[model samples]
Target: MSSPDPAARPGHAPPLRVLILEDSRFDAELLTETLDRTYAAIETTIVQDEQAFVQALAHDRFDVILSDFELPGFSGGQALELARKAVPSVPFIFVSGVIGEDNAVELLKRGATDYVSKGRLARLPLVLERALKEAADRRTLGIAEHRLRDAHAAADRIESRRMALIELSDHIRDMDDPAAMAYMAAQMLGRQLGVDRAGYGVVDTVAETIVIERDWNAPGVHSLAGVMRFRDYGSYIEDLKHGVTVAFADAREDPRTHATAAALEAIRARAVVNMPMTEQGGLVGLLYLNHGEVRPWPSDELEFVRDVGDRLRSAIARREAQIALTAFAASLERQVEARAAELEAAKEQLRQSQKLEAVGQLTGGLAHDFNNLLAAISGSLELMRRRGPLARPGDLERYIGVAQGATQRAAALTHRLLAFSRRQTLEPRHLDLNELIHGMEDLIRRTVGPEITLDVHAAPGLWSAHVDAGQFENSLLNLCINARDAMPGGGRLVIETANLSLDAQAARAADLSPGAYVSICVRDSGVGMSEEVAQRAFDPFFTTKPLGMGTGLGLSMIYGFAKQSGGRVGIRSKVGEGTTVTIELPRSEMPAEAQATQPQGLEPAPRAPAGETVLVVDDEAALRMLIVEVMQELGYATLEAGNGAEALRWLHSGRQIDLLITDVGLPGGMNGRQVADAARTGRPQLKVLFITGYAESVVLGQGSFDRDMHVMTKPFEMHALARRVKDLIDGP
Candidate 1:
């Protein structure tokens, strides 16, 4: 393999640079010498370790990587991985001793070009030659892909341009005035075809008379603007008569041309291509392309000229017909403008509706969470106060006061969110709409501001609605405030009340019931909404008002409350005109609840009874321990279990347990609810208090528990759990 070829053909190839990675110095040196002797152009670089192999690759580019499968510190796979990362496109091939077929396949999958056995030094050159050819093929494929993308982009551009031209042609055909259409057509030609001059010329075929009617050119070409004679040219007329394309590479040099030397000089003509226009066999006119410098016309350019000539001829023929169509187009334009205005109004309405809807969803979710927290806090506080001052003495009254305050505030917040979500527990009663508005008149006036004029238009015999008094009052107030903000420069705000009875079809269409309802409409002469705003009007937390000024929750909560109460909400707005928000609440048949003359807060009366040995079970040590303390202070001996299995184990061992108190979420095989269920089965007399952190966890949902099973959410203070336990043990 090292000997020179006897049939060697000299100077048949360029020098091939080979990167050789081998651990053994002796074998690398031998292969280098052998390659130098065998091939006239072969430069070899040898690196043993993976680091040296990688460094060589970074410093210089290589055609192929040749490495051994095994080395002292690094293997072929490691070198191959490093080489691929450095130069992803470069090919790699392994040369190792006794590598199995499976090992070779693995190397190939990892992007090695090919593998050659160690003793086959003679095949090394052949291997390198084939690898380089494959690399070249890959490079060729990559270039072809790039060219394909460019070609596709160009084709798309051409298609788009053609569509634009078609639209322009359609617009021209719809015009009535010949002179106007001709002027517009000349402008179109100058812009689309990059022409210096565009004109309409009248031609008489038999008489060979070509008259320029109207010309579009430089500012002071009035002499050439009028009709001109072309009868002197016989061959030019013949070319037009035959529909032949006439070309003059150089007018002075073309033997078939008919212009005099003076005329040619005045025109400054170099290259000219003229396409004839014909309707049937007779010639109509000619379209001309004149270049300042001498140039050959491309076939596509001539085809374009022919197309333009045909359009010009058809335009001239329909000149009178176009004039009659202008009135119809004008009417269409007016209709379109009116429709656009209507669409704009509709869009603004939609935006306001969507904003209200978003707010409703947000308020509903927030109220759900807020309610749980309130429940825990309130229950815990009630439980703590019943235990008296015996357990924590001096601190007992202070803790009770703080817990009660927090519970009240929490309830207030949830009440607001629920009002927004339209799911608040309602104590609905028949209410006089006129009287309610009259009562809220002062508040509404203040809300709308000094700049805005408040107008109340209550209809006679206005039906009353079944609504929560506080929420109804708040909703009206929110609408008035929003109206005030919208009319910063001052506008008229109108509040009116009326009756509405939606039919079955209207009910389904509006996603409401077919029933009578009372409406409170609030209209403001503020900046009206666009269509986009109207769609999102009811979306929770969606507001156009600057951040701090609006919660974006008011309208949404109102919308939810309306729907949940078997009624609906509506909005109307125009850009310059203002917005109207109307809220409808269901009518009630029951007599109205009399308004209380005064309101009072609850004061702590007396300590309640705490009896029976209650079992408090929880996985959290702090919570379980807190419950135990609360129960013990309440004069009840408490039994505890961390999870279900532990509780079950205690029951199985015959431990006396009165009531089971378990955490809903547990680490063992069973959850708190399941544990409670199992414990109740073993101990038939067991009462349970299920404590949980998540509202939608194991202890919640439609079928998760029996109606009577007591449940409480976590993050609760010691008192809430104790009161709930006492209540279950002592009864309502």
Candidate 2:
């Protein structure tokens, strides 16, 4: 190392301070003079002994040290050691005559900066300059190394703090309980920051207090859980609210903590770090760290505390939201349950109202229809009575016929009412719908009239349905008649039959069991019904027909019959378009039998079997007498009873009764079917005939009858009655 040339300086610089370690004043002055000869400025301190040198080194700063190799007591090596201890960064050079190369090399190795021999007195200035330059370079290097160590230490502190914050974040994230998370955060922060106590506080602006939610204290440290109130800390809280960290090395002496000093002293806190926690730009609380000894909080530690505050705030907010959401869900569930119960109650009320409404409609329509029949009967009977003796044979016969026709119409209407009420008995029989529809083609066309075109489309191999054949045919006729009335002019009427296989989905939607079905659809192009009218089409007595023009039980009867026969009915209609009514009946697994086609016209009264005895029972004496006379006229012996008890008496008496004829609705507490069942105990094959104005469904369950049994509605012609009796007597 060599000093820069003094000649290269632009101006005079500060003097170089030098220390001369020598016992001889002459040598020291000589050394100084040698340096002054080349240098512009110099300042020197000369010491003679180790004591003098030690004092100068301790009290003064120097650039370089020069010493002699040998002295009266101390050697240059000892001087070098003393200089090394006092000013380690300063250069030490030996300028002694007694010092040889070996000793000089040893001295340099022993921490002397350099050695200049007395024999080379002219080289002293150059050597001294070099020593001074080297000393300056060494001082710069030492400062840089010290700073580097400090930087490494600071970086390590940052990394450790960052890792602690990350661990705290993870712990908070994994915890669901707000209280637990708060306590855990406090504990982790206390350990990370090496504080005696750490705690979380929640702000209560309204109360002007900060509630200490959770706290963790190290061993032998007091907890701060009960400490609260911003007023206790005077205006210090205002600073925290404005996002300033409140820190103090000594709480007892800090002006900002004067109001809270007593409280701090109680907790044995010498220093404190109070970091504000904020949410949505408003101060929510504070994160507090308390130290039992005075501690100067570094900027990094303050920043870390702030970060923990943020994490705790977020965790608390999230936990609160979760609790609120759970409560809301429970409330919603309760509300839904209450609403559903209300809906069910409302639905039941609606159903009851609809039932009452249907009953009213039924009674009104029935009254209207019966009144019309009664009017016709009453008029015809009045006419007969008026024309009694003077009336021509033709006039008398016509009036009687009119009365009979009216009575028959009234009976038919009653039967339809029973059917619509779903109380009608259905005698289910395996029948092919396609064959049945085809057979009724001519009859349907005639019923619709010549104005309407009839199209019968029966699917081949149509499935068989189990339904009462007579009731089904009557239902079909009622549908056709309705179609005819719908169309004032002319329209195409299509009768279609199809085999359907309903899958699970379709069956569930239709409220039917999944299986095969047979459908009979009656479609017509006529003035269609609107949605409202169509919806009530199946309601008894609900009709769009003009008053007195319809009984309004036409569609209703069909709907009931289909349902009673284990089936459902669907109707599709649009205003000004057309209507298609479909009856879907479960497919019968039994093979369909070929139906016997009878002559359209009624046959002449058939004769009863010879020696056949008939028992006729009726509550109405006239009807009973009439049946007895008809049976006797057909060459059968006849007995008569007004009630079931009388007939049962004859049956129990073991009388030779060939056939039992009884009214279905008897007054003596026993109906026709019960008497028949009673008589069958004695004669299991006994022949019985149920004649009634009451629907057969009432007397005979499902309208089903065994062989040798028959049912005939009241108001039937004499020929029909005789024919039924004859058929029963002569079994197929």
Candidate 3:
């Protein structure tokens, strides 16, 4: 068999060279002829021995190595090992005559590409072709591996630049000062790009200049923090104005940088990059990076610098906006404070106006009421004076009664005013709310008239309340009358009593101590009030009635009574919805006491004890003498004093006194209570009667008194005084 020829081919054909280690000239010739005929072109080299084989391999390149398994000087295994040492990528195949199966397998195992028997020379060509194809595939794979490694290196560079840009962005966001942010951005960009210096410049179009606002330079490098005219770097500025980045490995060689070449050389800058920063379609500034040595700025590095410029621009804008917002907020706060002061002044003026209006209303009401009373008293006194001594006993008594009635009415009016003011003396007692409401059912029905329906709902487990029974009855009656007036067409009135427990939170809102309370609700289906009217419903003389219709003291008196009794009053009303007034009084744990029982039938006034002496102490001489005369007519001996000091002297004089009638308000820094307290040291059993016109001292004392003491308001009847005196002298 002949060896294949190894030669070069035309038209994109790969070159092939064969190394032949065969002793037989016929076999080598046969292989060469077979390859020359089958392939377009190939080259072949024949080496007869081991020495020739080594020499031929050292001097020439080969695609495949074919050898005889056994030769004159060596075996095919030796040739395979030698070929591996010389050219490890070359394919080595064995072709031999009379070779054993085991030997062929052994040859292939020891680095031989394949083995072909000389008897099967036809298979030699196919085996050789496969070996050569395999060798080509290995070369292609090596080339692919080298390219893969290069791509990985490039990817790593890109990732590093991306990481640096991300870190820069994070740093810029937290910088508040625009100038400081620019300096910091320049420093980071210089460090990241390994440049000698970096800076930012603001563009002045009108001035045709570029001002270096901030800059960062490496050690021993000059800073670029100065202004430069656009004319000095005309070509560079022109390129930047068109939004093109100007970069150069050699500033002296770049035509566009010629105008600024002298300045670049002065700074020892060999390479530079200028990236434009634009805002609102206008060039705002430029970011520059300079190198001491010439550098070809890579595409990736340029991209990173551009991103840094973008971040710097955004940070500057944010800082300016923040500064403006802070200034605006400060100005707004000052304006708010000024407006608040003006509103406060206006509110003060409105309060003064309301106060004057209230005073006028009170004065007008007082004048109207007192004038009528005075007229009645004056007319009665004139009639008596004109009829003097000639008047019939009945007529004389009638005239006197007329004057007395007017006086009593005036006194009642004064008492009501005091009550509404919360200055009246109160006699608090523990009483059941259910019982009080039930007892007043008859009076409430009469007051509301037959046309109105009245409902009394008393809770089963009613709690006792501590309050003045008489005052409560009066307040209830007033409410009923007001309800009747409101409902001219006759609606329903509901009075309910319930036990309530007020917690701390609820009690605070009502201005009361947190504890159990008894609630009394009076609901009326009448003409309801609006929010404004309801707010002022408890103001004295603030009446919604027509002139001469109401005194407007009903709700005011009720409010005062509730407060003085350590309770609270609440009113709920809305126009066209009706009204509900609720009174909550502190609950008493003590058992309720029976109300003072009145005699069913009128009994004759008891006469004073015979020879019983009484002391009369008053600040007014006329009042003292009148009291003395009344006692003397009752057939009792009387002693008189004009003041508490004088009364104490009389008591200390060892006078026998059955009762002491003293005015509560006295002069000389001594009150009736102190005098009475002192007189009691001498006569502990003396019965005391206190009289007052306004009862300021008594009200301050909470109206508390012992069983032997009694209080009477001024303008009382002579008959009432006489009856009280007789009762004090009599046994209880």
Candidate 4:
């Protein structure tokens, strides 16, 4: 290693010290001669052996060392290694005549500065020049690297300050609470960034006076709230006057400054930046940033402070708006909740109303069927009694009387059922109650039987009530028969019709619509009903009669009918005292519509003629046999097939069948409808009759029967079945 040659700079002081090791004395002297001629300030030391090389290195400092590859006691590689340990920065070179390119190149890798060949001594001065130049370059690099590391550290500090400013601005912008937002922004600038004191003051721009809103001073600093003024005689006034941010990089000696120097000194604040919060070119407030130590503010950082002031102004205003919106949303939610609750209540009321209406409809339908049956029984009995001698025979009269008593009791129960069902059809007609009762007298007498005495009590000129004549008669007859049933043995049955007006409270107590009405009452002495029986007596099929003798539908049907007709049906009974049923019809305000024209009489059914092939297909063999017998009696050729499959097979066989009578529900893989379908394939013009003990109406769509096809419920009378089939087969 060596210093730059002083002589190379011309008038430089001395020769740099240089060391040379060579196997050949000629090469060593050659290098020394080159240095001596090219550099006026050349100093040279020559070592040719390992011992000399070691001694020379420990004893001297040289500018550079020149070594030969082949030596007496050491190779150039060995000497080079020893030389670098003693002077790590010193330059070394190889001078060798036997050194091929490979060995010369290998020696240079061992930290040799340069290489010279004995045959190339003319280039020795050039090699010496380069070695010295390289030594200076290495030293220069060390100094440059040191300065580069310092520059990087300074750059990181600048970036960190920039990032902190950005984050502080973001924090202030995001604040939603007005007071809290100002306080937090002040704290971040004062505490986190080592400011001595920080505060925000709101100014009434019109009044131009500072109102200290939020402030934070470093530990042991006194409050500065009222001490600062915005109008006059203060440093903040200068900031307000300019409407521009003011920076005091060093607050120690400013002429425009007032007591702030002493105040900052008291708080140990060395510098300050006053950022003005302005909007629309007018100052609104001031955000003061104070530093605890003397530090210069970077331009970017000073700029960021102004941005934060702008954001703070917007944040406070926006927060107030947000609070207003929240209140409005809450009020809207309450209104919606109230409306939803109201709607739910209305829906419940509607459901209850619909339920009542459906119950009324069911009641009306059941009552219609019940009243028809009563009419048939009463009419038949009345005709028979009128033509009979049994009325005079005491024993026969007693039997008749017992039957009549039971019938009256049953009818009474039905009246109550019709009432509950709300189907009591009240016709507002100008009709005398006495006349109506008189018209039903014959039927009532027969229905009550000879054992049960029939009594009619009619109020004179009994008020004409608006009511269905047919339903009224049926209601009366139902009461009579129910009375008769209650008195299994002979008993007295009485019927009465009168006029009455009901009051509102009475109507409500009975759950009836308030109206005026006429009343018909039927009383009988028979086995009466208990409280439990009376309560559910109007429920369909709730009967105490033997299973085969009574269907509980009687009373429920009557109760439903009574209600539907705009009337009230009432019942009274004691377990052993018999019962009385009363029906009240609303008094007539409008006349009832005249009855529609009806067929004068049911046409006598045409008979199934002899030689007519009537197919009877039924799953039940007994039913099939009975049907066959009926068909034969009617002078028809009867063909019987058990089950739908057998029936279908018979029809497919091309049998001459005129009418197909089949039970709806069948076994053996086919139902009556399927059989009929298959039969129609063979006999396109075949007429089919479907019989069902269950609900055939359901299996057949509502009124789905064709004009030529008929449906008959099972357990029908033999004559009725024959007649229905014949009428269907004969009529269009």
When sorted by TM-score, best at the front, the candidate numbers are 3, 2, 1, 4
Candidate 3, residues 1-732, lDDT tens digits: the string is 223343333354665678888999998888777777766666789888989999998998888888888888687888888888889999998878867889888877877888887777788779988998898899999998898778667766665666777777788788887778888889888887788999988987667678886689999997777888866643677777767788999877898776677777677666988898888877878888888777999877887887888888888977877798578667656766877655665566568669978877877777788889888887787677667679898988998888888888787677677887777666678998788878889978988899999999889989888888888988888888888888999999999888889899999998899999999888899989999999999887889999889887789889988888888889999887789999899998988988776665546655675779999999787778888888888788999988877888889998788889888888877888878888888888888988877646542365577558877778776767888888777857
lDDT (Cα) of model 1 = 0.69
Better of 3 and 4 by lDDT: 3
The candidate 2 region of ten consecutive residues with least summed lDDT is: 1-10
Best by TM-score: 3
Write model 2 residue lDDT over 660-701, tens digit each, in one string. 888888877888888888889999888888887645565766
Rate residue 270 of model 1 by lDDT.
Answer: 50
Global lDDT for candidate 2? 0.81
| Model 1 quality (TM-score) | 0.33
TM-score against native, each model: 0.33, 0.50, 0.51, 0.29
What would the per-residue lDDT of candidate 4 be over residues 13-35, giving only the tens digit for each residue? Answer: 66768887866666666677777
Residue 438 local lDDT, model 2: 81
* Model 2, residue pairs in steric clash: none
Model 1, span 1-732: residue lDDT tens:
123343474755645677889978877876777578667766678888867887899897777778889899788888888888898777788888867899999989989999988788788878877888899999999999899778666555454445645765787787766655556655565455554455555568766776665655534323245554453322455776777878776666665554542354355335666667676687776665544455676564555556666676677676743454456557656766877755665566468668767656676656655666666675555456445436475566666666667676565555555555554544455788788889889978776778899889998887767775766787788889888888999999999988888899977887777888888899989898999999888876678987456556678778867775567889999999999998888887765556654324432322335346666667777767877776776677767777777777776777666667777778766887777777767776677776654433356543245644766654454655555665676663
Of 1 and 2, the candidate ahead on lDDT is 2
Cα lDDT for residue 606, candidate 1: 20
Candidate 3 stretches with Cα past 4 Å from truth are: 1-349, 392-397, 599-603, 697-700
TM-score of 3: 0.51
lDDT, residue 245, model 4 = 67
